[model samples]
Target: MTPTERPAGIVVVLAFAGITASLMQTLVVPLLGDLPRLLDTSASNATWVVTATLLAGSVATTVIGRLGDLYGKRRMLLVCSVPLVAGSVVCALAGSLVTMIVGRALQGIGMGIVPLGISALRDLLPPERLGSAIALISSSLGIGGALGLPLAAVVAENSSWRALFWGAAVLSAVVALLVWLLVPPTSPGAVGKFDFVGAGILGVGLICLLLAVSKGADWGWTSGTTLGLGAAAVVVLPAWGCWELRTRYPLVDMRVTARPQVLVTNIASIALGLSMYAQALILPQLLQLPGSTGHGLDQSMLEMGLWMAPAGIVMMLLSPVGARLSDARGPKVTLVVGSLVLALGYGSSVVLLGSPWTVMLVSAVCAMGVGLAYGAMPALIMAGVPETDTAAANSFNTLMRSIGTSVSAAMVGVVLSQMTVERGGVLVPSEGAFRTGMLIGCGLALVAAAVAAAIPVRSARRTSDHGVAAAERSAASVS
Candidate 1:
């Protein structure tokens, strides 16, 4: 089967499902205090509501993405929503932390949907509208995260936390209905066997890697468990890469990925992810710290979420504009602008930590920069590869972003641990530790810029559709 233009209803359905799925992670945060009592768990245990979703999301995305490439994206889209619905229902009725964690994991199936939906845009929208359409899909990740907190806060304050999950369930159901009615059926990519062996290794490897990253600080970074998991990941990922090269139909094509453009994009994606999350991890700490520190806002989660909401809105609103610019001017320009803005934003964060409003203003500017880079990346990947691998490639890109965020989170953890302020005085971080991470983000952004600038715009310009003759030749050279 081939794709035809989808009905407008279908497009809305896909986008809505994608967005609600994203809400699953952040929405749980507002209920942070309530969770411990409701679920009979410790405050620390309650954090798993967010972590479970993230862990499932990080692994399920790439695997499902590959499956989409091998099977059909539309089919996977329908199947994926089952978790969103089931997970929400489970959480709504859960009486224990263990059960809720399971539910959260199920809800994570939604994370993979965004990448799939973005790739699906090419199938639904006309060429003229494609840029903006992709922009909305890509930016949904941040938008859902931003919107989830405040919305959940309002719901939790007015009623119950269960309502949040229930709402997500209801929203997901609507998306499922829309997708069934809207998205056109299509064949899977690359005619061959599924890469079960490769998927197994990569999936397990990533889970161990993320478990280690998310819990490293709590578990003791040097603990036998953490060190063992780290070693396993080190051994497993490279082995998986090698196996992908040898396999006929790999879950991921290391060979294609090794291409200069793809490899460079992945590098930038990690940097972008880290830079994007800096405020996410840092600002909350700054805002919630004791006000006596002079730099702290001593805000509650609701206040912090509200303050940060504008940055997310900026990312959402600017994504389309950035996408159009990527199409017209090129992705390189968008990426460069995004990173520069990000560095500038952090610079503001360092200087104006006392004035929370200035941080919000600067963060929004950084988000605009992120919108540009995030929007341009998928377009760049799509332009370089055949349509067959679009969803999988997009998922892989999302994976890299997750990795970057995890890396940043873990590294930032180490930094915060080392830089505790004295019992009483102006709050001061280990200036060197914090700046090291920020500088790394800035450097990677510049590298992404360099990669984008080299896209051979004048010479490598392509028609909307081209013969698949070239990608097959490159792909066939796998061994």
Candidate 2:
């Protein structure tokens, strides 16, 4: 395992770990309808099962990624796995809503795996392979979600719901073992005290913002609680930014992030996040709603999951293509192309929404764009930041995407909630609402392309060759 030797096993192990962590996000989808009954809780309380994971993941990804940069990516990756395993076991045995939420929160903490894995690849892989490796790893976020739904749906349909958690626990344990065995130990990062205060301030702000977004519909969009949280986030996040800039060894380096390349990439990332999630929110509903509603396909949860699973495979398969594009034309160009593809996918949805198969095609096309865009983000971010700051920088980028998704949830939620048609005494999202959501997604994707196009290209002299050597040397030592 010299610097010259390629450790393909590390790529596989890290990608598997990332996919396992992401699967947790969608693992509970099939159980959503049954959750209240199983936990003997009210529907409103049951939603906490999902919300807890969202909040915990949003907070943990940034914190854990920074910790990985400060400590060791391999070390923190292993640490994240413990929570996933333990959380799965807790969920397996849980008989109450409170316990389920607790389990989900624990599972959310493992969401750091994707960012940490991407960062680790920079340290562990050869430069030639780095792009594809990052692409595959980043795309795992969507890959796992797409695959998990159908698998979880089938499992939940035919077996005990506890089996999902049990399966997850087993998979997590395997990931932990594989990482411990295959991932090379790296040198500790920047020699400075952890920024506890900075982490805390950022955490609180994110929690408030995400909570407001995720729960706003349930809580009443104009309610005092939502407005209060929104206002607090507006204030606290800026305060956190100021604190990060002033603090030594900050959790995230604002100076580096503020660079035009990094800043615009992140801005585009938010738009891509919004675009990616709009389909997730819209397609399943369209598939599951009663066909008598005209626009609805009336598929079962399992059927809908099956329809969506191929998109995950398509995303994984497209990762290498994205990597090639990044290597050929730069990640900036790759990102712009990806954004256009995403817009095309949503546009196709306008006409393809009629059948399950056509909708699947639309999803696959969108996923291809996600595969391309998700991969380029890390490439773009890494190119701008130094080696020591890689994990934290990437983590912040991951956080930006999460923020985008949260906003998408709120936006689409408003539309679907407002434009509804009555079907058999129940209100369902009208065809018009679904179409509007798709159009919004299309427009946002185009916006993302514009932002990406605006990012300035770097000169060869400004790019750091030392960073690349350091990463190779680090990988060589452990190998």
Candidate 3:
């Protein structure tokens, strides 16, 4: 590929890869109720099907990103796809809960593709085109989550559940082929010794932290197991941080990460993730709960998914607009706009709870905010870090969002569990409880807006200079 050649094929391929990776997050949501029966396992065991993926994805994303920085983004991308393809096939043939958990863990490894794809945009796309390309790719995270639910619900309702896995397998294979053909090879990565020690330390800490967050409700938050893991993380993570600072070629460069611009953007990312996921958690249930409950929409799973699917489309449509905004007003301004929109969406939910259409409208508004925020986040991080640290920094930012979502799930679970109404001998979250969750989401979004407002304007100029330098290096390598 020449410097003058456009990267249309590259952007599409990378975006498709991102969508493929994110689809794994929601692929099994439709199967949750049926999982115990399908695998002949207890409900607690079935939950691991979800938890395992979360843990694996959290760890794999960080680890694979550092590896991509050391090896090559395109190479690691292909490496990541192998697991996705194999995991989907294994899942298609899975006969037990254990097999399903293993396969899901493998699928989680593929989540690295999203950040790798974003970092690759920094490498291959021109400075002028980079903003929109990055926005579209980043927005795919929300797009896949939004679309996957309805798509999965339809497949599960109409066919053997196994067909879902088979379809994912085919898609993963296709993505691998497309990436190989469309994505051009870049220069060799930073030559440094692989930090196995740092990787192990970080992996253990994240696994412990995430497991406790995702399962603390089921396991009893203060139980010995949860407490022990929590305690271990508190100790392990700080130690991991100390080590990163001391090491010569750390997996993540703590100095760059600690910069005011980078640190503040990451902090805002967590809040944004919490705000975005809270709506996702609450709306579907409100739409699907028994209408007899008076507060519920009395819709089926497929109906709920269909209602929610439009939000994904709205994110995709709004992403390019966000890119233009970033170009005109700077990413920090775009991020603030996104955060305020997100808060407005949540505030609207307080009134929109009466009907399905209103709920969808609120969801679409939130998606629009999410599309803008997600697009700007990577641009901010890329601006603050050197080109060599691009993948690692983006991956860390991605991890912060996952952490926020995990915390949201735990906090929302606590609220819904505490404030429940009896319905047909089963307890469900009350209308007030859902409203409270939305309020919390609104508050988080406002916090994000405040944090984004604080990022220095000087960071944008710094990033532009770095981008030009990086592009020059890329062109020289290609020649």
Ranking 1 against 3 by lDDT, winner: 3
Model 1 lDDT per residue over 1-479, tens place: 23444445555666676778888878787777788999988987887887898889988898888778778888889889999999999999999999999999999867899888877776555665666666677777878887777788778888877888888889889878878877887567656787889888998899889988988888899999999999999999989989999888888777667667667777778778876776677766666666765446778777877888887789888976776666655665666677777767766655555566876786677677777777777766665556667788889999999988888787877877787666365445544545554555556556555655554422233212221123223433442
State which candidate, 1 or 3, has the greater TM-score.
Answer: 3
lDDT of 3: 0.89
Model 3 Cα lDDT, one tens digit per residue, 1-479 = 76327588889999999999999999999999999999999988899999988999999888888888888899999999999999999999999999999999999989999999999887787787888888999999899999999999999999999999999999999999998888887654566877888999999999889988999999999999999999999999999999999999898889878878789999999989887899999999999988999899998999999999999999999989988888777788889999999999999987898999999999999999999999989988877777778889999999999999999999988988999999899999999999999999999999999999998644334233234344334433432
Q: Mind giving the per-residue lDDT tens digits that candidate 2 earns over 1-479?
A: 44226468889999999999999999999998889899999888888998899899989998887898889999999999999999999999999998999999999999999999999987787776787888899999999999999999999999999999999999999999999888988666766888999989998999999989999999998999999999999999999999999998899989978977789999999999998899999999999999999889999999999999999999999999988887767788889999999999999987899999999999999998888999888878887777778889899999999999989988999999999999999999999999999999999999999999998755322211233334334433432
TM-score list, all predictions: 0.90, 0.96, 0.96
Q: How accurate is candidate 1 locally (lDDT)?
A: 0.74
What C-alpha lDDT do the candidate models reach, one value each? 0.74, 0.89, 0.89
With candidate 3 superimposed using the best TM-score fit, by how many Å does residue 183's alpha carbon deviate from the native? 0.7
Flag clash pairs in model 3: none
Candidate 1: residue 24 Cα off by (Å): 1.4
lDDT for 113 (candidate 1): 93
